[model samples]
Target: MTQNQINQSAWAEKWPAPAKLNLMLRITGQRSDGYHLLQTVFQFIELCDWITFHPVDDGRVSLQKPIPGVPEADDLIIRAAKLLKAETGCEQGVRIEVEKNLPMGGGLGGGSSDAATTLVVLNALWGLQLSMEKLMELGLTLGADVPVFVYGYSSWAEGVGEKLERIDIPEQWFVVIKPNCHVDTKEVFLSKDLTRNSKSIRIADFIAGQHQNDCLGVVRERYQSVKDALVDLSEFSEARLTGTGACVFAQFDSEEAAVSAYRSLQKKWQVYLVKGVNESPLFSKLKSGNIS
Candidate 1:
């Protein structure tokens, strides 16, 4: 069958859009083009926002349920679908339904993961059969973090967070807390007090516990809720902010320890106990032919 005449029901299935945590974020320098040079480690967490696509023969991309306060045009999922359609001259379209469990602006890469899932799922649904490199390139147009989700593995990243090399790390449990606030990443980056220069360290140094987030100081000073979350969580373990701000996390040796910490904080904050994985859940489903 031609693309426009394909059956919609056959392609309908749920796909995972897994959240990520930045194990370490270091600002190595600033680029002349106004982008920050970053050295960071990205690992997937089992926490995810599930997305399902229903093919539409009308050739117009849309969201089945629009997110509050966000216009459909501005939704990254819609943008991703449109970008894929336009780039490949595909006649197929889809209505996306997002079960948004990930918090917005929480430094958990929720939106980027949603966008990456859109690109990956649509590429397959539309039968475009695009190469992995091509999908990663398309994902980069959505956001810096989107490509990592597209790559579908834990990775060490550099160069505005695009250059990636796959790395395997311990599968530890984490207690993630989202404070009652939003952190604007742009504001954090623009802060004059933000650390812009730090000596680059090897992965060995990271394993040796020689890394810290350069944005932590500015985030702590500017966002009191984040500061409070950090201080409170630290009482249980060494809590550190992920990505820019608004969410802080601490690692534990076992699920019981992480759950204990999470239980203590649950009444006061929005918390999650997630297991870190080297491979994304999205890829796991794909490899197993759970979605096609």
Candidate 2:
């Protein structure tokens, strides 16, 4: 069915905000604008944070449960809803309920994914019918990672992560380990010793496994927890940092291998076995008519 044909009532159903992993991250250069020029591969995982929106006639966007330490005014989900409402001049509001599962500050892009899902789902829910390109454009104002989620596909990304080319990648299982501490992205990026001049590589080179997370060395040196987790996980497979991370993941050809790794690691650290996905679960729900 066409987006315009989707009933507004369908907006009431829950939607998914899936997590993403940077299969590889390379820092090519720093722009004059202070944004880092980068090349990265982004792939989604089956794990997700669920969101539900309830229409409110009062025309004031709010959240059912405010995320601790984040004011409603600053919450990305509410901000996304308000942005959409103001952009379209729609006389509708929503009480957003978030079932957050993804870990914050794990480099999993949880908050950005939530913001992207808010933009995508609410456009249809409010009957604004904005195109995907327009939605992604709006998402970029929230965060660099937000556009990828709004694009709803695995992608090869560059130019501070806004430029995207959708790519199909091998579907594999990953053993992900989350350490006990948070790695501040701003701190990692601002470190004096951070690598900012990794040689640029081609997509073909990335597919052949020739790229690495430039932020990993800085992060490991600054955070002992992350260092320990990476050292432990690397014993089983080639564990790598995902974005400026407190979390590291290793890909395996089969679920059984990933599960085996998870089982061994869970005894010493927090771990999960997840499958890589090319398509976002939000799109799957829309196609299956499961949104309502």
Candidate 3:
């Protein structure tokens, strides 16, 4: 049977598109081509959007709400599928089902994770047989953080977020709060006051000392909701913005502590207690053919 034939025989199950937290981001420099050079640690959290793909005859992709306020053509999931099919010469098309749980533009890397999940699962379903590196290369066209999800491991990221080194992060629970406001990453980067000249530090250095997201200042200024969320969550722990804005997170030593914090804020905010994972279980299940 051909690739499409195989996919048509079974109903594709939902795959995980896990959200990520940039524990710390430092802008080292800007590339001549306009990409930012940065260093950061990316941690995979239990918070995710689930996606399932079904084989389709026509070359098309689709989405389900709550939409991220972007056009369908600009949706990263479709862009990712089209890119993979073009690169690998796979004629198969897929109808995507996205159950979006993560907030849009919350700096949680939600959309990028969705795109990367498409690339990884479709590579297998379409029988592309591409290595993770090759898939990651394809993912880069979708976005910077896409590669890390394709890498399927908690990683240290740098250099426009493409360069990745797998790292063992401590297992912990996180209280993530989305203030329901969107902060555009481009605006934050272009702002004059945004820090773009922090000294580059080694991963070990970050592990040992204070590290911060350089985009925090610009994002906070533009979004008062995020600022409020940060201040509110700070009572539990030192609240920090993950990527650019709109979501703030605090780490807890135990699941109970995280859940307790989440429960307290449940009445007012969208709060979640998510555990950090080194490996994505969705990918593992797919690799082992558990979902086929």
The digit string of per-residue lDDT tens for model 2 on 77-152 reads 9889888988889988889899989998899999999999999988887779899999999999999999999999
Model 1: per-residue lDDT, tens digit, 66-85?
99899999999999999998
* Weakest 10 consecutive residues of candidate 3 by summed lDDT: 3-12
- Write down the worst ten-residue block by lDDT for model 1: 1-10
Cα RMSD to native, each candidate?
2.4, 1.8, 2.5
Of candidates 2 and 1, the better by TM-score: 2
Clashing pairs for model 2 are none
TM-score of each predicted structure versus truth: 0.96, 0.96, 0.92
Would you list the clashing residue pairs of candidate 1?
none
Alpha-carbon local distance difference test for all models: 0.90, 0.90, 0.83
Can you tell me which runs of candidate 3 are displaced by over 4 Å?
1-10, 63-69
lDDT of 3: 0.83
